[model samples]
Target: MENINEALGLLLVGLTTVFVILYLVGLIGNGVIYLTNRFVPEETMAKRKEIVKGKAKPTNPAKIAAVIAAVEAVTGGKGKIEKIDKIDKIEK
Candidate 1:
């Protein structure tokens, strides 16, 4: 009876300690994020220049649109793609 009560008491204390620590960590993390977002200014990105090469094929606007659509769909319209670089095929 005494052993059982002691075990239950210890369990309760351990669980409460864990919950309180986790809650504090979450609060601190949220505070840090809020402070950074409030103080930091976002930078504007430069416009992409069209690349023209003698032998390279032209980039398709349709492909870029499709990729943007896919990303928006996956993020439920919250996803933002800053830049997308196309890899070139190389010959050995």
Candidate 2:
């Protein structure tokens, strides 16, 4: 009984020590991340948003020919493009 109690106590102590060490490591990591983000310059962290602005234009004949060729190749000449609609760009 004494040996069993001693083993249980050692197990509890080992688990508690590991938990405390892991908790401290997580806190330190979070603190480092917070400090780094707080001190970083905005220009260095700014990301560019690519915006394409253009009016709805007719599709080029060369592009249409290429699309028709690709579809024919994929479907063994069974596919056909009846109509092609131009998508207008939305301005934000």
Candidate 3:
């Protein structure tokens, strides 16, 4: 029937319009993100650099020395005990 064909055609057209609109929106959103990243970029690289450099400081020197001493004790003098620097605890 002519009415059935018209209804099917209109349904297909509506679906096609919705798909195109969604595709365009997604494309535009991605473009905006890319542009913003290019122009107004955050300091991800700088923060990463700082994080890499910040780990170089020794946190617990006493814990490290204790671990080393235990390893030497287990190894039975194969590992000579290095000179242990006394770490004074910081009284808060």
Residue 52, model 3, lDDT: 59
Q: Which stretches of candidate 1 lie over 4 Å from their true place?
A: 44-92
lDDT (Cα, tens digit) per residue for candidate 3, span 1-92? 99999999999999999999999999999999898778864777566555456533345766666767777789985886444333234332
| Sliding window of 10 residues with minimal summed lDDT for model 2 | 47-56
Measured against the true structure, the TM-scores of the candidates, in listed sequence, are: 0.47, 0.47, 0.45
lDDT string for model 1 (4-64, tens) is 9999999999999999999999999999999866776543111122332223333565676
lDDT winner: 3
Candidate 2: tens digits of C-alpha lDDT, residues 1-92 = 99999999999999999999999999999999998789976654552111122223343656656667888999999998765544223122
lDDT, candidate 2, equals 0.68
lDDT of 1 at 55: 31
Model 2: CA > 4 A from native: 46-92
C-alpha lDDT score of every prediction, in listed order:
0.69, 0.68, 0.70
Residue 21, candidate 1: Cα error in Å is 0.3
Name the candidate, 2 or 3, with the larger TM-score value. 2
Ranking by TM-score: 1, 2, 3
lDDT of 1: 0.69
Alpha-carbon shift of residue 1 in model 1 (angstroms): 0.7
Residue pairs with colliding backbones in model 3 are none
